[model samples]
Target: MNDHIAPPTAAPAPALQPVRAAGIATMTALALAGLGWAARGVWQIRLAMAGEPASGPPDQGGGVHRPLTSLEDSYHLVTTVSGFAAAVCAIAFLVWTGRVRDNARELSGTRPRYSGLWVYFGWVVPVVNLWFPRGIIADAYRASAPGERLPRSLNVWWGLWLIGMLSGVGLMYGDNTDEIIARAYAHVWQLLASDAAVVGAAVAGIFVVRAVTAVQERHLDEP
Candidate 1:
C-alpha cells in the first residue's frame, strides 16, 4: 500500500478586472482627446494657409499680414497636449499588454515574454521610422490576437493611416512641389487626408482597447 501524498494545488491568480477597466478608460480618453486635437490642428492649419489672417498682434505696420494666428497657436498647444496624452496612454497599454502576455505565458507554464515600445516608436524616429512602425504595428496586432486572425477593418484603417502619414510628411517636409499650386490646393488636401487618418486611427484604437479589456477579463477569469 502506497502512503505517498499528492502536492497541494496552487491558488489561482487574482482577477485584474479593475485594472483592465481602468486601462480601457484611460486609453479611450487619451486616444479621443489626441485625435480630436490633431483634427482641430489640421483644420486650423488649412484655414490659415487659405489666407485667413492671424488673430494675434497685428503686423508691425498695422497691416494684417496673415502671420501664424492665435488659432494656430492654440492648435499647436492642443497637438502638444494630445501627443503627451497619447504617449501616456501608450505607456499604460504597454504595461497592460506586458502583464497580460506574462500572465498568459505563466499559465501555459512557459517563460514570460512581452513586446517592446520599439514596435510603436518605429513611426517617430526618422526615415526608417516612416514605414517600420507600420510593420511593427501589424506584428503587434498579430501577437495580441487570440487566434492569429486580426480584424480586416484594422488593415483598412492602418492602410489609410499609412497613406495619411506619408502624405502629411511629404507636405510638411518635401521640396519637389510647385509652390504656387501646392499653396493653393495641395496643402488643403494634405491636411484633410491627415485628419481623416487620425479619425480612422481613433476609431480603431477604441476597438483595440475594448479587445484588450476583453482579453484581460478572459485571462483573469481563467481557472
Candidate 2:
C-alpha cells in the first residue's frame, strides 16, 4: 500500500503589469522642444556675430534697433523657459525610469543587479553616474528580452546621453571665463554642440523607452 502523496503544484509567477510611459513620452517631447529653443538662441547669437540685423518686427522710428532688441529679449525668454522645462523633464524621466526598473525585475523573476533606489541616484552621483546608469539600463533590457537578443537602442541612447551630459558640463565651465568676447565665441560653439547632442539623445531615448515597454508587455501576455 503506497502512502506517498503527490506534490502540490507550484504557484505561477505574478503577472507583470504594463509600464506606463506617458511621462517618458512627455519628457522626450520637452527635450526636443528645448533643443529647438537652444537652436534659436544659437541662430540669434550667430546673427549678432555676423553684424546682421536679427529678423523680426521693423524699427518704428527713434532710430532704435527694434528687431535686435526683440531678438535679445526673445533669446533670454526662450533660454529661461527651456531650462525650466528641461528640469521638469529630468524629474519626469526619473520617475518613469524607476517604474521601468521595477517592471523589468518583475518580468525576470530575479533580483535586479542594482537596487531600485539606484535608478534615481545613479544619474546624479558624480563619477558613479558615468557608468552606473548605463549598467542598470543594460540589465533592464536583458531582463526584458529574456531569451532574445537585446537591441542596440539601449547602447545608442546611453552613449548619446552621456555625450550630451559631458558637453553640457563643458559649456558650464566655459561660461566661467572672464574674457567677454572669448566667452561669447565659446558659447556659440558650445551651444551648438549641446543642442545637437540633446536632439540625438532625445530621439534615441524614445526608441529605447518604446522597445523596453513593448518587450515587457509581451512577456506579461505570454502564458
Candidate 3:
C-alpha cells in the first residue's frame, strides 16, 4: 500500500505532438501571408511605374486604380493577422528550444548555457540580430544531435536570408532620391525580390528545424 503513494509523475512533459503541429501550421500560414504581401506590393509597384502613386488620395481623373479605402482596409487586416501569427510562432519556438536545452542539461548532468532570452536578443538587436539567431538555432540543433555535424540545408537557407536582408537594405536606403516616383517604383521592385527570398528561406528553415527538434525530443525519451 505504501508503494502506491510514490510521488506523482510530473505529467509527462506535454507531448511535442501538439507543439510540432502548431508550429507547422504557423509556418505554412506565415509563409503564405508573406507571399501574399509580396504579391500585393508587386501589383502596387507595377501601378506606380505606370505613373500612378504608390499610395495617396484617389485621383480625380477616374483612374482605373481601386479605391484607397478598400485597399487600406485589406492591407490592414492581412498585415495585422499575419504579423500576430508570426510573433506567436517566434515566441513558441523560443519556449520549445528552452525545453530542449533543459532536457539536455538533465540528461548530461551539466548546466544549460543558454535560454529563451538569448533567442529574443537575436531578433531585437539591429545588426548582430540577423546572423545571431541563425547561429543560435544551428548551435541548438547541433547540441541536440548525437554528433556536431549540422545539415548543409540549414546553412544554405540561413546564408540566403542574410544575403537577402543585406541586399534589401542596400536597395532601399543606398541612393539619392532625385529621380522622383519612377525611381521609387524601381526600388519597390528590388525590395520585393529581396523580401520574398528572405521570408521564403525563413519558412524553409522553420520546417526543417521543427522536424529535427521533434526527432530529438523522441530520442531523448528513450533510455
Candidate 4:
C-alpha cells in the first residue's frame, strides 16, 4: 500500500513566463527601427547626389566654418535620433529573448546550452558573437518545442545580421555629420547594402519571434 502512492508520475512542467507580450514588443521595435533605417538609406543616397559638403563649405575669411545647409542639418538630426533609437531597440530585444529563454527552460525542464548572461554579452563579444546569439535562440526554440524543425526565418535573420555587421556596411555611423557623409564617399554601395540587409533581417526576425512565441504558448498549454 505504501508503494502504491501514485507510482511516480512525470514531473510537472515548470511555470512559464508570458511570451506574447515580449514578442510583440520586440517585433514592433524591430519594425520601427527597420523602417527608420530604410528611410535613412534613401535620404543618404539623395543627399550624396545633391552634393553634401565634404569640408563644411568654404571656410569664412574670419576662420569660421559656414553653417550646414538645411538638408545636411536634417540628415544629422535624423541619423542621431535613429542611432539612439537603435540602442533602445537592442535593449528591448534582449529583454524579450531573455523572457522566451526563461520560459523555454521552464517548459522543457532542461538547461539552456548557454548561460543566462550570454543573452546580452553573446551579441557583443567578438568571435562568439558570430554564432552565440543565433544558437541561443535556436536552442530555446528546440527546448520549448522538441522534434519540430526550426523555422526558415531564423536562418534568414541570422544571415542578414551577419552580413550587415561584417561587411563594412557598419561604417555608416559616426560622431559627426561630416564624418558620416565622408565615410559614404567610396562605400555608398556597401552602406546601402547594409541597410537592405538590416531591413530584411528585421522582417525575418519578426517571423522568428512569432514562431517561437507561438510554439512556446502551445507547449505551455499541454496537459
Candidate 5:
C-alpha cells in the first residue's frame, strides 16, 4: 500500500514583470526631479517678486529690464529638462499600467472595467480624464487587495494631480502683459499653487505606486 508515489506538485506562479517595476522606479525618480525643478522655479519667482535681484542684475530705470540671468536661466533649463522627463515618465507609466492591468486580470480571472488602451487614453480625453485614470488604478488596487478598503494615497495623488493640471492650464490664459512690472506679478499665485500641487502629487504618487506594486507582487506569490 505504501509503494504508490505522490504526483509532482505544480510550480508557483511567476512574479510580476521586472520591467513594470523598473518603469515605476524610473517614473518615481523623474517625478521627484520634476518636483525639485518646480520648487526651484517657485523659489525664483518668489525672489523676483520680493524686489530682489534673484541671482541677476537689479532692475534699472527706463522700463527696460536686463536679460534674465542665473536664476531665470537655470529655471528655464530645469523647466525644459523636466518637461522632457515628464514625457518619458508618462510613457513609462502607461506601459507599467498595462502590465499591472494584465497581471490583475490574470490573477482575478476576469477583465477589468476599462480596456487596456484606457490606461493611455484615459489621461488625455477631456472631462473623463479627471476620474478615468483614478478609476483604473482603483480597480487594479482592488483586484490586488480583494475586499480591503481602497488606499488613501490614490485619492490624494489624483486630487493633487488634478489641481496641478488645472492650475497649469490656467497659467496659459489670463492677463499676461509684456511690461516688466505686470509680468513680474502676473500669475505668481497660480504658479505657486501649481508648483505646490505638483510637489504634493509626486510625493503621494510614490506611495501609491509602492503600495500597488507590493500588493500585486504578493498576489502573484499566492498559492
Candidate 6:
C-alpha cells in the first residue's frame, strides 16, 4: 500500500475582468456629476451675491413661511438634480473599482488587501472610509503598472475629496441650504473655498481614473 498522502489541489484562479469599457463609462458619469456639482456651486454663489434673504420670521406654532424667490427656488432645484446625479455617479465609480480590483488579482496572482465588499462600503463606513478606497486603488496600481512611480494625482484627488466630504458640500451633510446660505452671507470666502475644493476634487479624480485605467488597459496587451 502507498504510505504517502497526496496534497490537496488548489482552486483555479479567477479570470481577469475587462476594464476598458467600464473605465470609459465611469469617466463619462463622473464628468457629468462633477459638472453638475460645479453648477450647483455657481448657483450658491449667485444666491450669496443676491443676499439669500429669509422669507419671514421663524415658523413659531406652525405659521406659514413665505414662498421661495425664483433664484432661491432655482438653487433648490439645482441642488436636487446635482444630488441625484451624484448618487448615480457613485454607483458607477464603485462598479469600475470592482472590475479593476479583479483584474489586479489576475495580474498579480495575489488577493487584494481589502475584501470585495469594501469596494462599495469603504466610501461610507466611517473611519474605514478614510483609507480603504485609496488603498484599493493604490494596490491595483502597483500590481498593474509595476515600476511606475505612484502618481501625485491620486494623492491630490483623495485629499481634496476628503476636504470636500468631511467639512463641506451635500444636502445630506448637516448644514441645510438656508443655513449654508446664511453662513455664506457671514463668510463668503469660506463658501468659495469649500466649493473650490469640491470642484477641484472632482477634476483631480478624473485624471486619477484615467491614469489608472490607462495603465491597466495597456497591461492587458502584455505577454
Shift in Å, residue 13, candidate 4: 3.1
Better of 2 and 4 by TM-score: 4
Best by TM-score: 4
Ten contiguous residues with the weakest lDDT in model 1: 175-184
> RMSD (Cα, Å) of candidate 5?
5.7
Q: What ranking emerges by lDDT with the best candidate at the front?
A: 4, 6, 5, 2, 3, 1
Instruction: Estimate candidate 6's RMSD in Å.
Output: 5.0
Candidate 3 ranges beyond 4 A from true positions: 1-26, 29-33, 36-42, 45-77, 113-115, 167-186, 220-223
Clashing pairs in 1: none
lDDT for 42 (candidate 5): 66
Q: Please, what are the lDDT tens digits per residue for candidate 4 over residues 1-223? A: 6876878788766788888788888888888878877877877787768764656433334656567677767877778777776777798899989988998888777788899999999987989999999998998999887899999999999999898787643365332555556545445676788878888888898899999989988866777
* Per-residue alpha-carbon lDDT of candidate 5 for residues 11-79, written as tens digits (9 for 90 to 100): 656445644465466567747556764754565475456553543333444665677655555555655
Off by over 4 Å in 6: 1-14, 54-64, 169-172
Model 2 — which ten-residue stretch has the worst lDDT?
176-185
Candidates sorted by TM-score, descending order?
A: 4, 6, 5, 2, 3, 1
Query: Model 2 misses residue 35 by how many Å?
Result: 4.3
Candidate 1 local lDDT, 83-146, one digit each (tens): 5666676666555544544444444454323245544455567776645644543444444444
lDDT of 2 by residue, 81-170 (tens): 666667766776666677777878876788998997788889889998988887886788788776776668778877877877897674
Report the Cα lDDT for candidate 5: 0.68
- Report lDDT (CA) for all predictions: 0.53, 0.65, 0.55, 0.80, 0.68, 0.78
Relative to the true structure, candidate 1 has a C-alpha RMSD (angstroms) of 6.3
Leading candidate by lDDT: 4
How well is each residue in 1-223 modelled by candidate 3, as lDDT tens digits?
A: 8987888776444332223554465556546645654654554465455554455434333543345444444544544555565566566656665555554544444444555566667666798777777666665565566575777767776776676667756443453222222343445566566656766666666665565566566665664
lDDT of 6 by residue, 72-148 (tens): 67867887888887888788889999989888888889888999999999988999999999999999889888998
Give the clash count for model 2: 0
Candidate 4: list runs displaced more than 4 Å.
1-10, 53-66, 173-176
In model 3, the worst 10-residue window by lDDT is 175-184
